[model samples]
Target: MSHIHIPDGVMPIWFVLAGWAATAVILYFCMRRVRDVELGRKIPLIGIVSALMILGMTLDIIPIAYHINMSVIAGIVLGPALGFISIFIVDLIISMFGHGGVTVVGLNTLIVGTEAMLGFYFFRVFLGVFGAGRLSPGMSAALAAVLSLIISTCLMIGVVYISQINPERVLHVHKENPLGKIFSLEPEGENKRHKIEDKRIDIETFAKTVFSLGVFGWILEGVITGFVIRYVSRVRPDLVLSEVT
Candidate 1:
């Protein structure tokens, strides 16, 4: 739901290059850390999780531009390293389908990967905070999902706010519109009045709108994540939070 949908040409060149460089560095480290045996075992799990994420991203609620990311679930199952790889793959595929732009893939991957990392660590933290005996796996997952989403939302908003400052170029509007010429009798300050009437978006409005729209989707995903984690904990106990359980 928080993924950047803006196309390639819109973002400054420096941002695009930085995104690719950062993603490459992270991928290199992840590859170095995982041994051949562990990599082989993770391949199938990565595929399954990537497929689920891609599918979730494809469906959006039109009115709100919202969709479930399933980032927390992937994090819980795959942990941070493999989860980042999975998110990159998923973002790459989604870009090909025009869900997000190709050049922005690295940026999108980084943003979503943050969510996975936060989700995974927070899940463990919550478990520890509540103590093993006090909280169920479902409740722990739900708490993690909620907290992670809040953090992810802040990160995304920060990125957007940063992007808007000192952009590569600015277009100055000095010429009057053809429509204005045609409607010569239009009152002075009419455009400004109309802009105010329509409520031009600023940082405050954008932030409010984003969170307001996503709050419900986030909660729904949190509950679903809790249930899925609980099920996995019951059956394939070795796959998730095994030590604590």
Candidate 2:
């Protein structure tokens, strides 16, 4: 839901370069942090998680143009370093398909990877707090995923604000509401209520519209994340809890 699909030449070149450099540094640290033996053991799981993320991103919600990321699921199962690495792989592969375009892959990774990291950390925090209360794994995960997505969504909006991108060019999504062609989701005609037509849109307007739509995606993904985590915990506690810490 928080993925940025801005094509090349849209974002400031300096911002794009900075994004790549930051992503590279994070990747390096993550590589250094993961042990060689551990890396070998987790390679298959990493591939599985990355594939799930990629697959989840392809399905848009009925009317919101939002898609699930399964990123929190990655963090819950794989731990932060591995999860970020997995997200990088997902972003790279998706960029090839123009999900966010090749030039914005770095930025996309940073945003979604932050979501994954926050998911892991917030899960840990909530686990500690809710453990005494006996909160179900599914419930804890749901809460964590929702909160992580909210923060990541804000971060994404911040990027667009800083880059001075208009809403139309932000995610570049288009849809025809089936309820009636009474309106389209293209940010055109009557749908101008959702976006600005000028080169530099009002950040407040963009943020408001995005959050209104993003809340649905966030909660839905959170539910999915929670259920997946619960299932994994039931079958392989070692994978979700033991190794993540």
Candidate 3:
């Protein structure tokens, strides 16, 4: 739900370059912090998580373009550093398939990876708050996923608003409901009237519209991630890296 679908040449060059610079610095520190033995252990896990995310992304729910990011689960299992690198790999590969523009891969990675890291840290926080013995791992996972997604959605809304992409161009309307078509971009000239109506919306309106759409997606992702994490925790606790306890 938080994925940026803006094509290359649409977003300004400076923002795209800044994305790359920021990602490079994160990768540098992550690489330096991880030990060789941990790296060797993480590579296989990274590959598995990356593949799952790619597959999840490729299979969208249509119209809404909603897909499971699975980034929170990845963050819990792989840790923030490797999770970020894994997201970079997934985003880059998908761009080659024309899923997103090549120029904006860096920005996409940062946005998505930030949520993954947030999910990881927030999972710990939520687990603590809910009380480890009182709350199951599944519930903790679900709560964490929702909180992380909320943060990601808000951050993405800010980025889009700041970029000044006409809210009219970025969103559309359906059946006379403005919020119905949040983030549903179409080819230029597809629906002039819809664009005209969208222009009437300000950034606050746009943010509210997108958040409404996001609520459903977040719930679905949270439930699925929660169950999956619970299963892994029960069957193979060693593979579950995050401190869900």
Best by TM-score: 2
Name the regions of candidate 1 deviating beyond 4 angstroms: 61-65, 133-135, 165-201, 242-245
- Evaluate all candidate structures by whole-model CA lDDT and list the values in order: 0.74, 0.80, 0.77
Q: Candidate 1, clashing residue pairs?
A: none
> How many residue pairs clash in model 2?
0
Instruction: Estimate TM-scores for all models.
Output: 0.81, 0.83, 0.80
What is the per-residue lDDT of model 1 for residues 134-157, given as tens digits with 9 covering 90 to 100? 337778888888888878887777
Tens-digit lDDT track of model 2 for 1-245? 68886777566555777789999999999888885545667999999899988888887767455789999989888889989999999999988887887988889999999999999988888888778343477788899999999999999999887776554544443333453243222223334334545656678887898899888888898888888888887888888785652
**Which candidate would rank higher by TM-score, 2 or 3?**
2
lDDT, residue 189, candidate 1: 25
User: What local lDDT score does residue 225 receive in model 3, on the 0 to 100 scale?
Assistant: 90
TM-score for candidate 3, please give it.
0.80
Please state every model's RMSD to the true fold in angstroms: 8.2, 9.8, 8.8
Q: Tens digits of per-residue lDDT for model 3 on 40-83?
A: 66788889999999999888875556788999998888878888
What's the CA error at residue 136 for candidate 2, in Å?
2.5
